[model samples]
Target chain A: MRIPLGRKIVTYFLLSTAALLVFMPTLMAVVMSFMTNQDIMTGSFPSAFSLDNYRRAFEQFSLMHYVINSLFVSIIIMIGQLVLSSLAAYAFVFLEFKGRDFLFYLFIATMMVPFEASIIPNFHTIRDLGWIDQYTGLTVPFFAMAFGTFLLRQNFKQIPKELREASQIAGMGEVKFYLTVVLPVAKTSLITLGVYGFLTSWNMYLWPLLATTNDSVRTVQIGLRQLQSQEQMNDWGMIMSGAVIVIIPTLILLFLGQKKLQRGLTEGALK
Target chain B: MTEAAATLSQEDYILFEQTKRKHRYKQFIKGMLFLLPSIVLFSVFLFYPLLRTIYLSFFLTDASGAPTVFIGWDNFVTLFQSSIFQQSIKSTFLFVLYTVPLTIVVSLFLAIIANEKLRGIGFFRTIFSSGMGISVAAASVFWLYLFHPTIGFLNIILDTFRLEKISWLTDPSWALIAISVTTIWMNIGFTFLILLGGLQSMDKYLYESADVDGAGYFYKLRRITIPMLSPTLFFVVTVTIINAFQTFGQVDILTQGGPQNATNFIVYSIYREAFTNYQFGSASAQAIILFIIILIMTIIQFKLGERKVHYQ
Candidate 1:
């Protein structure tokens, strides 16, 4: 059952090539970030690496403010989606109410409708609410998500029904039972949802671009876009530095939460 | 005594029915309370916008984004007749065609290779899946560096080989292809993860049985692995197509749908129509048309997948 040595070699070669192709861009970005602007334009490796690009990126571009804006928006979205989706999921799973099935379908149906279809009206809604260029405009509309609710509901339904009945019989209120038992049991799914929500909000480009016009509220993705336009001709190193800064947080989150992110993505697909 | 007992049973039944109705009301109240926040947000953001898009598509709007007059079918007609709109449609489909199948084929190959049990496999898997963490904007910047005509890494490589440098993003012929390369690279990590998960979860017995029957590697792959992997393949294809259709960020950052509008994706067109030109009605029409295209394409995929996908 042993494969030939030649075949193994080919397999390794291909896998290694694919892996390098995937990782090379980010690595090049990092490499270019350390080089001088002259070195980058000349396509030369840095003789002496410096943090000048990073310094210029922050000082000149106000990269810190955009990072803070992105962090604030993503964190709020993560917390909002987790809390709201879990509550709705709990009701969908544990409570008995008329039109429950119909309501669940309605929520799920929203997943199919592309966000582009709604961007204009949602913009108008925000403008009317006088939330333009505000934190609320950037984060509030994304607080409720059908995907998070669906993921949590599927997990919640797997919890035994008798546990809920037992809690009720012991004179425990629904809120108390949910807080004590359900939340703890569904922790993994919640973490998965949180990571997914955070990444999506953090990487959001079009909506944030439309919503925020200035540096006061623009997210990191928009900041990158601005950097590209503002420094149109030169300063490759500084712009790559900006790219590195924008990507660093997401990479850290991915490395730290790889298991949960993978699980979140593949969970419903298998079913 | 028997008649009195029957009367008591009936009275108890009535009391039980009253309590059940009251409990139902309470449960309904609690459910609505739990759902109230989500409902309000969804109604304001998702549902209302969807309906409004349709409604606005039928009107002619002013420069201020307010509806000025009722223009029935005018916007749709104008877009349908416009050559740029037509080109956008062609380009959108071409984008999907360029990205989807290649993503599936290449990622599946990588997944199969990475699926092998070897030393340092986890490191390789992480490298293969690392693109998942890179956002569209960051990835676009990296690619913009690589595809720059005079001072690009790719052209540098071409120079070493004594070959002519290609104008990747600036040339109309190469613009879409360059954007497609970036998207394909960006998508590889996601599609690889999904396919690798599928490969890991496959039943090993089928491969063993095929070996016992004296089947060659290609035969086993064709007969066993492909059929067994259809469900995952179906899922990957659907997601890749949908994502390809909605491609915006890379196009915006890299090409600005330029080089003679070679990379003018439908979403970018929609964005320009609304924001840049202040033609909200036209943008709404374009968005609706894109939605319809995506919807029909998805339905067609589902219909085709229903017959081919294998289920355990």
Candidate 2:
């Protein structure tokens, strides 16, 4: 559908204006991250940009340490969710046992129990496990996801039945079939689950705050909190730099998987 | 001789049925093996905590969260009478009210506009959805900077317009609204993406038919687009409302449930009651309340969503 010239101009005008409004806050943060404290205090766009804030953030806040911890935890949780959820989804779909639907629904029902409902006991569970300030504490509870399993199951269900029959006919065991056939065929779905897992884990705030007291186990989100809450934390430039660092990895992931990730994430949520 | 053959066949049939039953049982075991990890984790984290939170709500607990006394809803009574809890309840509902509809309407507008098949549309789509990339901590820090009492960009803008600067975070009147603005900005990314995906996946043939009938832009939007998009809209609204109720990270960072507790939503209240104050019983009660509110809202939305909203 081709638009008239005036309409096209108006469309572009509206789109650009809306985009700028949406991006304005982050854009300000990005712009301010390079400026000195004086520029930010005066609310001026500076003529000179400096890496001083980035350097100070790393030195004083130990921001890089938190970045690594966030990476380690997020990736570990992603792997755990991928493996465990895929296994459960494989059983739910490929096994075809009696009461399968019953079990699947039972599993999916847990999605209703938001973390707020369960955070108390889970905190004690971690503390009791002596996992406080441990990577395991930060990563383990999130390994089993009702939503991830459901997403994977939805995709796994789409695998052709004929493929399963062919595998069995070829004397391929179910375990081997899931490994070589089912998982590989559902590759896109797996990436979707993986990206979703990574993003959620990376952005987690409360649990990480509760689970880790020390910088040794703190993720980037908690790191930002600690940095912001520090006494005399008035260096807006440095704090903005830390904020920029925390978001870069996920943004990179989103950009790389832009077109596909949208569809993937939407399918994961909607299905 | 024929009778003997019939008896032998019946014995063989019984033997075959027994083996088949044994094989089916083995498959069940295998499936359970696949599911065992998740089941164990859920039992440990989700199921146990959910039940424990409910159970703990009725009983007073000492420090370390050990139940010391069974209060029989006295904790709830205290919460009802408590002025702070009342404020939190008010703040939470108001927070949802301030955030959800505005977020939905704004993002829906952006999604529809971004859906236009125009030049450089991908750039606009990326800009609109980039909020999905930002973390709560990062976004809050940015907001904190912007909401600073002095030398904040927002204040700078206000000064430029010759309007007196409002205390964005400290003033009770404006704190929740400021935080709500942050929440709305944070939400636009995911809501827009989902809504845009929904808009794009719609069958183009409907639009084609509308074109043939000489339907104008507003006519097609009103008669065709909105109704067709209702399911996605319903889904977005449900999720957004649930998220609004669970507003925590921003509140914790921005106000710490402060400035007269104007921004202390229920989740933050629960966090303080349990973690900071060690009043596990009160916190558990609050948790259960939050859960029920979300559950009821979800059920109501689904009920309405089932019969009315979703045009499916």
Candidate 3:
């Protein structure tokens, strides 16, 4: 079962090279974030490391505020999707009624309508309700999710029917059984869905751009845009620093939830 | 219950039927209740906006986005004739064509190589799929610096090779390619992870049988691995193309559809039309067009997937 040493060496060389190539963009940004503008211009390595770029990124650009706002909005959207989608998915899996398939497809059909395709009207509706520059505008519209519901429904379907029948025989209400028995059975997939929701919301760029106009409500993605515009050419270090800052939390989450993320993404896409 | 029902009289059977009908009614209400929260949100957000989009696409709208006059098919007419909209459509399709295939091929290569059992394969796997953690704006900015005209690392490398330096994002000809390179890189992480997962889950017995048959590596790959990986490959292509179609953040941050609208993709065009130009009617028409294209693409994908994929 063991591979030969020659093949192993070739595999290692190819993989490391590919990994470095794949990671080069990020690696360069991290490296240059510490370099001085002069050093960057001169194509030389950093003479001395400095926090000046990080300092300017926070002070001159107000990236700190954006970090907080993005976290708040993403967290709300994440929790909202998990609670709402899980409830809807529970109904789809456990409850049988007239027009069940019809309603389920009706929900699934929303996934076909790209938000970009329907964004103009949604913006109008949000503006009419005076939600522009508000967190509600950012978070509320994403609460209902067809994709999450479908994912959880798949997970729930894998649970044995005997469990539900036995719970019923034991005089357990559907609601109680769903919370205590059903949710726990699919806990890994649920967490996977939650992490997926969080990643999607965290990486959201288009909606937040239209939804918020002020620094108080802007996400870090928007903040990065502003920083680039304000300091386009002269401050490469600061811009790279700002980019790094925006990526920190997501990186942390990825490191913590790598397995769940792989599971969630593959399942969500293939299914 | 079956034995008891066999002994039941005709009147009792009628009573049982009535009780079953009542139970269905009760279950229906309970199901609706569980679904109520999502339904309410979807109705207000997704369903209503969709209808409004269709309605407004048929009308001329004011700057505030309210319908001012009913114009039957005029918006679509204008959209078809406008050079800019036409260019946007072309750019979008080209972007899809440019990014999807390259993303799949390269990701599959990495997945195949990384699938080998090595001491530090786990580390390589993580590094290979690290782009999934990067946000679009951040990734765009990183690429922007590397694409900087005056002092970019890519151009620096080119300079060392005694080659002419190229403008990464300035020239119209190179800008879309630049954005495409960025996109292909960004897509690598997700696609690689999915492909790697698929590769890992394949049965070793298939490969062993190929070995027992004295098949060479490339032959086994051609006959067994690719066929087994077709499902994941199909899924990856569908999602990658969809992502390419809806590309926005990178375009906005990198080029802003600049250098003569070479990168003015459909989604960005819709944004400019509605929010900037206040042409909701035209934007809605464009959105509807995008929707139809996606709907058709999705249908084609599903059809091909069902018909062509090999399953074990």
Candidate 4:
């Protein structure tokens, strides 16, 4: 169908405007990060770029520790989620068991309950377990993801049953079939879940903040917030630099992981 | 295919698969064992905290980190009585009022526009959606500079337009609006993506059918789009309401609920009471209130959603 010219122009205008508005802060942050303290205080864009803000951010904040911590957490989260979620999803798909559907739905039901409902009890549990101020406390709780398992199970369920039957007829054990066949087939879903796991782990704020009082275990998010809250004058340049530093890795990861995200989305969308 | 099926007896297949099937069941049990950690984690970490938080609401706290007195609904009563708490409610309600429907409408508009067969749509979607990755605290700090009175970019624009300068973070009247705008900008992309996803999945035949009936774009939108998009709309609204209630980080970072507590939200109040004042009981009470509000709102949304949403 031929679309009207006016609607076309309007659509383009609105989309570009929305895009610019969404991007304005990051753009401004990039500009502000290079400016000196004087430029930031004076509210003037720097005529020439300086490395002072980056230097200060690195030296004073020890931002690297937080970034490295965030990376460590994200990596562990991804690996743990990939292995655990895929295994659960695989079992749900090919395994015929009593109460399977009920249990699977129960897992999905947890997704509807907001984190607020869980926080108070979780705090006590962590306190009881003496896991507070520990990385295990931070990572262990999120290692099982119902959403990831659900997504992967949907993909895994699509595999031909004959493939499993054929493997069995050829004297392959169910474990071997799952390892060799089911896993490789669902690799894309696993990657997608890994991306999601990484993002959630990286962007996590409240739980990590609550769980770990130790400064050493603080993620980039906590570090950035801490830097902002320090009673010193608002150092826009350093803060923006910190924001940039925090954001860059995610951006790079997103770029590489976009294909996975899209693929996973398309697969889920097909449902 | 028929010959291959005939060559393999159904009995042989069932028997061959029987051991595998039983083993698969065992594997399923083992998988649940792997899933057990996450299940136990969420139950302990999430459900337990929630219950404890609720329990903490009935008591009063002294400086010694203990509940000194049993105050039956006193905290709730006090929460309603305090002008500050009232102000927070008003602030949080105002935030929801401004952010929720506006965000839904604005994002829907953006999604509809983006969903069209336009060139470079993917790039625009990516740019807008990138905002979702940035934390609320980070966005607030960025906006603090952008909305700054003297050196801020917003002021620069306002000055050029001969408009009076607006103190975004500091001024009582404008702080909520300022924060709301930033919140909307930060979250609009998320709802936009969701609506876009919904829009993309819609069957094209509906539009074709609308065209056959001589429906204009608006008619098609009102009739076909709105009804079909309601599920996504419901999801967006539900999530946004939850998010809006938890508006602590931005308030903490940007305004600190300052300039006469103009932007003090409910969650921020809880945070301050618990951590800042170390009034653990009172803080826990405030958190319980917050939880109750969230729980009620969510249930209402879901209940209303079941009735209201019409899938095509």
For candidate 3, report its TM-score. 0.96
Give per-residue CA lDDT, model 3, range B1-312, as digits (tens): 877766686668889899999999999999999899999988888888888999999999999899999999999999999999999999999999999999999999999998898887878888888888899999999999889876998899899999999998989999999999999999898999999888887899999988899998789889999989888888788988888999999999999998899999999999999989999999999999988888877877777767654454
- Per-residue C-alpha lDDT of model 3 across residues A1-271, encoded as one tens digit per residue: 8898888888888988898888899998998888888898888888989989999888987889999999999999999999999999999999999988988988868878888888988898899999999999999999999989988998999999999999999999998998999888889988888888888898999999999888878898898999998889888999999999988888878878886788777777676
Worst window of 10 by summed lDDT in candidate 4 chain B: B303-312
The CA lDDT at B4 in model 3 is 73
Q: Against the true two-chain complex, what DockQ does each candidate achieve? A: 0.72, 0.81, 0.80, 0.42
Model 1 DockQ reads 0.72
Quote each prediction's TM-score.
0.96, 0.98, 0.96, 0.86
> Which structure is stronger by lDDT: 3 or 4?
3
What's the residue-level lDDT of A125 in candidate 2?
Answer: 92
Residue A118 accuracy (lDDT) in model 1: 73
For model 4, residues A1-271, the per-residue Cα lDDT tens digits are 7778998898888888877877888898988889887877876658778988899999998999999999998898788787767767876787766677887876755655566544555665677788887778788777777777778889888899899888979999767887899889877777777776787688777778788887878898888888877823668789889988887877666666654575565444333
lDDT of each: 0.89, 0.89, 0.89, 0.77
User: Please, what are the lDDT tens digits per residue for candidate 4 over residues B1-312?
Assistant: 997777677768888899898877776676666457666755665656666666777887665445678888887888788898889889889999989998899888887887888777778777766766677657777887788788788998999899999888888999999989888887875677677877887899989988898989898889989888777677788888889988766787778888798888887787677657876776777777776788787677657766743433
DockQ leader: 2
Q: For model 2, what is the alpha-carbon lDDT of residue B243?
A: 93
Across residues A59-142, which tens digit of lDDT does each residue of candidate 2 receive? 988888999999999999999999999999999888867788888877867867889878998999999999999999999999
